[model samples]
Target chain A: AQRVTQPEKLLSVFKGAPVELKCNYSYSGSPELFWYVQYSRQRLQLLLRHISRESIKGFTADLNKGETSFHLKKPFAQEEDSAMYYCALMHDYKLSFGAGTTVTVRA
Target chain B: GAGVSQSPSNKVTEKGKDVELRCDPISGHTALYWYRQSLGQGLEFLIYFQGNSAPDKSGLPSDRFSAERTGGSVSTLTIQRTQQEDSAVYLCASSYNTGQPQHFGDGTRLSIL
Candidate 1:
């Protein structure tokens, strides 16, 4: 079965500092990874996908087959960057999500 | 365009009572999904509906949980004899088709007292 693991439950970073949310998955087949974000009082939205290889809101994630990881990263975290982030693995037409990481960008 | 919409943004029901959560997928979206968001469990896939195909109930936790999508647009998840453990945010999402990015709803926070 495919599974996603987000090691960090919570992360606190100063404004303008770098923030990295670690995500690792286990899947026998080729994996499709995605990062979803949910802001306070907002619906969960797609942040980025590995297949696109394009950064969204200054966040980018690279899928590493060797490491089985697809960690999301942002060079300079901003106040609005605080949100709950989830790493998901898509397989068999469904998604398996991680426990998620709550990031807080403190000013 | 409007995103996926879920009704009863918040629901409070007593244990042993039945509750139904509604999900209205984005117009023109043929793939709809149901998920449960617990305190620390992230999002757990509950079911999937694609067009007129049979729904996938493999992710459902128990017999008390069931879902149905009518006319391939609106979906309703029914939980019979709800338990406290069922108290969580029920989320619904929809996509254009397979392998497409899913647009999520605001979610309905179900609280069982």
Candidate 2:
């Protein structure tokens, strides 16, 4: 079985400050990690995947095999970046998601 | 449709009543999935349908939960004798194929009275 854990339930930051949403996972086989975001009144959407190794909306996540972590980071937070973020692990086409973290960016 | 579509954005029903939720996957997508999101359980996979093959129902919480996809496009999830614990946001998602990134719907909020 695979599991994803997000230690933080909520994170608050001032505009222009750096932010990080931590995520950890436990899986026996190779793991595929992804970050998904849900904006207010909007559907959940894929933010980025570990395989892609690309940044989206100034956010990036690095998959660390030794630590079994895939933490999402943004260099500078923006008001528009406030949203609920979920970390997920895929195994056999089924995704196991973390409890999620709500991010608030204050002006 | 352009993206995954789910019907009945919100539903409130008696505990013993049966309820059905619908999901319309993106056109040409071969993989569809159903998940339940609750305050305590986060997101739990319920079932998955790939093309016309037998669905993977291993994630279903109980026998009272069942789902079916017809013509490999639209899927319906039926809960029999719904219980208060069944109240949650049921979400539907689709991908072009297994291991592909999924696109999700707004989800249907089921409230059991």
Candidate 3:
């Protein structure tokens, strides 16, 4: 069985402040992690993937095998960054997603 | 279409009625997936299709749920005898191939009364 846990349900950060969303997964096989973001009035879009190792919209997540964690982080948060963030683990050609964390950046 | 497209942006149906949701994946995309999004449940994988191979129906909750991709382009998800618990946003996504980043549709919001 594979499961993804996102500890935070809601996060509030001031503009220009750093933000981190915690995500932990339980999977026996090599995990493929992804961060998907849903902005207001928009469809869910790929934020970043662990395999790609590229940051999108200043957001980056690194997969930690030892800890079984893939936490998304941003150095400076912006109002546009406010959205629902989901951590997803792909295994067996299917995705298991964590209960999303809603981020609100206050100006 | 340039992106994944789902029909019937919103649907209101009574319990016990059957409903079918349609999805048109991006042209040339070979991989299609179906998911359910609800209040408590973030996203639940329903089924997946890759090329002509048999679909991975393991994620489907019950026999009442079924999906098929026609000619590797359009996909339809059918739910029979819907229940109140079936009310949720059904999402469709597609990728160039298996294990690739997927592009999502706007999702069809189903409300069972």
Best model number under DockQ: 2
TM-score of every candidate relative to the true structure = 0.97, 0.99, 0.98
Per-candidate DockQ values are 0.88, 0.94, 0.88
Kindly list the per-residue Cα lDDT of model 3 for residues A8-103, writing each as its tens digit.
Answer: 999999999999999999999999999999999899999999999998888889899999999999999999999999999999778889999999
What are the clash counts of all predictions, listed in order?
Answer: 0, 0, 0
Q: Which candidate do you rate higher for DockQ, 2 or 3?
A: 2
CAPRI-wise, candidate 3 is: high
Residue pairs clashing in model 3 are none
Give a tens-digit lDDT track for model 2, residues A1-107.
78899999999999999999999999999999999999999999999999999999999999999999999999999999999999999999999999999999999
How far residue B48's Cα lies from its native spot in candidate 1, in Å, is 0.1
Predicted candidate 1 versus true structure: per-residue lDDT over B3-86, tens digit per residue: 898989999999999999999999999999999999867699999999999999999999999999999999999999999999
Q: What is the C-alpha lDDT of each candidate?
A: 0.94, 0.96, 0.95
TM-score of chain A of each: 0.99, 0.99, 0.98
Q: How does chain B score by TM in each prediction?
A: 0.97, 0.98, 0.98
